[model samples]
Target: MRLRDHVVVVTGASGGIGRATAEAFAREGCAVVLAARREEALEATARECGKHRGARTLVVPTDTTDAEAVEHLARRAVEEFGGIHVWVNNAAVNAFGRFEDVPLEDFRRVLDVNVMGYVHGARAALRVMREQGRGTLIDVSSVVGAVTQPYSHPYGMSKHAVQALGSSLRQQLYVEGVKGIHVCTVMPATIDTPHFQNAANFTGRKVVAMPPVYSPERVARAVVKLVRHPRREVVVGPAGRALVRQSRTAPAVAERVMARQTEKTHLSRKEEAPATHGAVHVPIAGEGSVHGGWGGRRRTGMRRAAVAAALAGAAVAAGRRTGRGAPGC
Candidate 1:
């Protein structure tokens, strides 16, 4: 569990949470392997990681959807670093639109990258980890996986599948009596990452993360912690935790609230963006960064107020129901 000199492979290392996580591991003195479809970006991330003394890095341009490519990525990590201690599956894509409005091909592409990509990475990592007798596999899911959202049906569906996939893998591992191999899922709230901009758009409006956006570094920190302390799942950010709690406690209310909030704030009609498939089928060329420039827009007060109002409303409703059943006193 100690990270110093440990070999870690991180998929989707070119940008967003993946890039920040690679840097985090490097700071822990781990030999990091950066995997993504963007060779130049991956190399850039590798250079950043190399800045840390005693930390080595390998850049592997990989399309996770390709089973062979993912396998090769794993082999290269073992061949270079001698072994893999932690594998992080963070590669994913999204399409924005109503379920019917989104093209079928685009929807399939989302599944291929978000769901199948994680599967391929897990399979390859498990093969190496089982041989090594100890390794941690981390899959980056989302709060949407637990609670549904509007205008992002494919993404939500894929994340749900990711949660199920991790659970199933863990169960099988337990049955096989596999020791030292751990599967963990990290579900984050709306993160201030390039995802909104990179996602394929069909809504015509500019996409934006909802209020109370958490920095990608927050999720990156969580991922690094999981390296040493593996758990079944970890939800990043207070907003995400609140949403998950609400979903579990009041499914109908949560769904209705989320539907309204998503439609109102998730997309902006002021700005215009043309529809594009994004990186679903091809690599986006750039040396991506960790932050998505939404820091100034974070509405922490608004988020806190919303949570308080919801709690108060729930309490009032419960009081009303109790009063209705109580006899005159």
Candidate 2:
């Protein structure tokens, strides 16, 4: 589990959480293999990683939706690094729209990239791990995986599948007596990443990273920790952890709250957006970085606190109106 000279393969390493995760492993002295559809951006990420610890990196231009390409990616990583110690399935895409409003093609593309992509990574990584008898596979899922949102059904469903995938993998590995191999899932809240900017949209309104947006680097750190001490799952953001707990205890209330919150917060009421497939079928070309220009980490905690207080006040006000409690309550 030591990171020194550890061989880690990170998919979706072009930007966002994947980029941050790769950098984190690099800083730990791991030899990093970066995979994404964009080769130039992967190179950019590799350069950034090399700046830390002069980490060794290999850039693999991979389209995760293509099973053959993903298999080749695994092969190339092993060839360069000798073996895979950790494989992080971080490649994913989103399409924001009402279920029926989303083009069937776009929805299918999202599913293929998000769900089948992980499947391919898991299959390839496990093939090598089973031979070596030790490895950790990390899947970057989302809070929406546990709690569904109004729009972005394909994304939510795909993430939910990721959650199940990890769980099923762990259970099977345990019973099968597969020692030293672990499957871990990390579910993060809304993260400040180019994910929103690159998402396909058909909602007629611009997509926004809802408030309480945690930095993608935060999720990256959680991933690094999981590599040290693997767990079945971990929710990265405070808001995300709370929402998952709420969904587990009060499913109906969580669903209703998510429906209302997503409508009010996830889409810009003022900004208009024309339908376009963003990075679903084709990769977006640009210099990519870890942050999405969202504000710093200090603001995230403040916003989460403010939102929680407002929601609590609203509940109290409704209670008084319904004559169910004292006026103060």
Candidate 3:
């Protein structure tokens, strides 16, 4: 379905890819409903979307993990912009550490927000879309869903579940012959988001080691493209997409490489200094700096360019290794 005249609801709209995606849809002339826990941030995103000229936007401070809140978000979007045409499940959290070292509560929180949050949005959107007989459901999964690393068990598990959820939902849709309704999963590499810093970590360090980091806008743009044309899955970046291909071609080799990488990667759980209110910094942007500057075309363009460059570099290195009949020399 075209975004120009459709209504879209985006969870985790306060920052990162969600914020970028809301603006993207608005630029496409889609009326957008932005939802997240932070009201002020959501308002800021809404204002940015409003600046885009073609789209009308609404902000709903919503915690997507809350079923009631998600239901309300869906209802409000319909009330304000007619029926919902697309729903993007982008809310997620991370907790890095050995499974035993990570607290049970922390694991639960991540699962609730990352896994169950998708479920909540999917359930709510499916209800309205099925009634309307048309809709698109977009899920932001991760490369971890396909190949996991050490110390990221909770996050990986959540992503894997989300992938399964998307797969199952798509199959169910086909069985029901739900014309015009689509579900898709987007798996990306380590995004340059604050997930590393703000995510609950048992190691107490900042930023785990991931060779290439893509910007949130890279994934955000993919979401926009997917909404325009739904697919079963879209893996963002050449490196990430290639890894999925490699996994299918040589599962054992991919597994060994990932296991070695995970073993060598650093795991930091160091807690940031609490603010005056005793709240830790929420890692929505990224550790150390926000790559794309605030919200803008130039910054977004630069971020995507950087990620594309990294992807190209990785691909060249991988190709060289393959030519040499070695994984890496």
Candidate 4:
């Protein structure tokens, strides 16, 4: 769909990937609706979006866990912009701790925000799209949706559920002969976002993204691309794709590697963080930005090399399985 003047609604727009996505769509001249529990942050995002191509922006403070709030968000978007062309569900929260150490309430909160939130958004968007007979819905999942990670049990579970939700919804739409309504899932690798800082921490350590973190803008670009050419799923970074492929081919090996890597690097013992519920139960007040501080420290060159090697290995394996020689051989 042409982005110019199209109405796009993005959840979790207070910060991180959602904020970047809102700005990206705005650059394409789309009228954007920014929704999150944080009113101030949503307003801040609205201001930034407005600066792009003179795009019109609406700030709707929505807690996606609440079905009514999410429904209201969709209603407001259409009330203000005529119709919903695209809807991006990106709201999420995480808690870092061992499965046994984390509180059950926190685990449920993660599911409520990450899984139920998407469900609410999808339902609302689908209703509008079914009526209009056309629209796009993008669900921002994660690589962990395919491969489980240590110290983030709840998060991994929620993402996995999101993947299932998207697939099921797509199949339902197809069975019903719905057309022009596309459901796309975007699974990104570790992103340099404030997600770690905002997560509910019980590990008694500072949370950090593993090395080779991709920038939020990278994922945002993928979301924008999906607006025009929707696909079933798109993994944003090479590291993410590699991990997903590895998990599928060698689940035991992948599990061991992730367990060790996460334990060693995903948490920092030097910095101390008190246990807090974060935004799981309440909204945070602040104007959040796109890039988290981790970007400057990323090991880009090494990551690129690793990705290239993984791709080459996959190609060779494919050739062998098909009883074919390498290209030019």
The reply for model 1, stretches above 4 Å from the true place, is 296-329
**Candidate 1 to native Cα RMSD, angstroms:** 6.5
Instruction: Please list the C-alpha lDDT of all candidates, in the order they appear.
Output: 0.90, 0.92, 0.78, 0.90
Which candidate should be chosen as best, given lDDT against the real structure? 2
Residue-level lDDT tens digits of model 1 in 189-232: 99988888888889888898886788788898899998778899
**Native-to-model Cα distance after best TM-score fit, residue 289 in candidate 4, in Å:** 1.6
Candidate 3 lDDT by residue in tens digits, 1-329? 45699899998787767887788889888999988777777888888888877889988988877899999999999999889999999978777667788777777788888998999999999999999998889999988899877777878899999999999999898898887899999998766654554566565455453645667777888988887788899998677887888888998888788877765554433533221211022434321222333233454467679989999999999998788896465
lDDT value for candidate 4?
Answer: 0.90
- Residue pairs with colliding backbones in model 4 are none
Q: What's the true lDDT of residue 136 in model 4?
A: 94
lDDT of 1: 0.90
- Give the poorly placed runs of model 4, Cα more than 4 Å off: 296-329
lDDT tens per residue, model 4, 1-329:
56797899999999999999999999999999999988899989998998977599999998899999999999999999999999999999999987898899999999999999999999999999989999999999998899888888999999999999999999999998888899999999889888988899888888888866888888999999998889999998887888889999998988887888888889995888888887778766688877778872255656778889999999998879777554555
Q: Which is the winner by TM-score between candidate 3 and candidate 4?
A: 4
- Between prediction 1 and prediction 2, the one with superior lDDT is 2
